[model samples]
Target: MNKNIITLEYRISKLLRYGVMLAGALMFVGWMSMLDFTQNPLLAFHDYREVTFVHSIGYAWRDKVWGLLTAYAGLILLISLPLSRVLMTAILFWRQKERLLSGIAFFVFAALIISFSLGIEL
Candidate 1:
């Protein structure tokens, strides 16, 4: 039982580490590619505008802006990591019959969902 728990924890940690690494790599690639793009960085900064997420995604796609797309993907993955981790933990705890821990994990997962879904930007 002890060894099993250790192995499960190791696996979970490994998953999280790999997820971070992947997200970092993607962001790095996107940033590097953005540097190589034709736009002048200073000019882009001067023309800064706020756009909704859906509009940004559509523009990135329509304009064939691979770097922006890659960067956005990485950002999304990085942002979602914690939520995924919590959900995974909840599932694993439930599977292991850890009633209290599982309940806590599930409650946390729900809270995260609610926060993201219904959270107000102040």
Candidate 2:
């Protein structure tokens, strides 16, 4: 493997690990916040039963639920990490003059974008 490829691999691994840890931390904060108000950990589950991916962020923001907002932010970050990796791969492939791999990486990135957009309900 090229040195650049090895470095990219290490960076991508770190990105994934940090993304997961951040998401988990945000969720834990949200859970703890709910516990503060409800006095029971299980009660926190009820608050999010009706939450949906598209609306939760806005709702959390509007409601001023710091925990929920942070949790949603973490989720968004988690989702974007892979997209970032795909983008990085494309860039690295392009720099390496590997046109075919670069094109494929770009195609995958585009597909991910389209799928994410389609998932949102109007």
Candidate 3:
């Protein structure tokens, strides 16, 4: 492998690791908050699943549901990590003059975006 590719791989590895750690930390804080809020060691599925993303964010800010907000933020971060990797792959392939690989990477990225958008309801 090229030195540049090796370096890019290292950077991508770090990005994934740090992203997961940050998300895990946020989730841990959210879990602890939930425990406090509910005064129970175990949580029910309905506790966190009752609101949509927009509503959870609003509740997090306006209704002081910090746990829900933090948890959702963590989930969003987790979901975006793979997308970020795809984006980085495309950029690196372009920089290395690998046109075909770059094009494929871009195609995959576009497909992911389209699928995600399609999954959302109006």
Best by TM-score: 1
Tens digits of per-residue lDDT for model 2, 1-113: 78878987898899889888998788777766645644655665675466566587677778898877776667778788889989989998899999999999999999999
Better of 2 and 3 by lDDT: 3
Q: TM-scores across all candidates?
A: 0.84, 0.78, 0.82
Q: Once superposed on the true structure, which residue ranges of model 1 sit more than 4 Å away at CA? A: 36-40, 119-122
Backbone clashes under 3 angstroms, per model: 0, 0, 0
RMSD of each: 2.7, 2.8, 2.6
Q: How many clashes does the backbone of model 3 have? A: 0
Ranking by TM-score: 1, 3, 2
Model 3 pairs whose backbones collide: none
Query: Which 10-residue window of candidate 3 scores lowest in summed lDDT?
Result: 37-46
What is the Cα-based lDDT of residue 31 in candidate 1?
78
lDDT of each: 0.84, 0.81, 0.85
The digit string of per-residue lDDT tens for model 3 on 1-122 reads: 88878987998999999999999989888877777554456546547665565665776799888887788789889889999999999999899899999999999999999998887643
Candidate 1 residues 7-99, lDDT tens each? 887988898899899999898898788783466666677776888777888999999989889988998788789998898888888888898
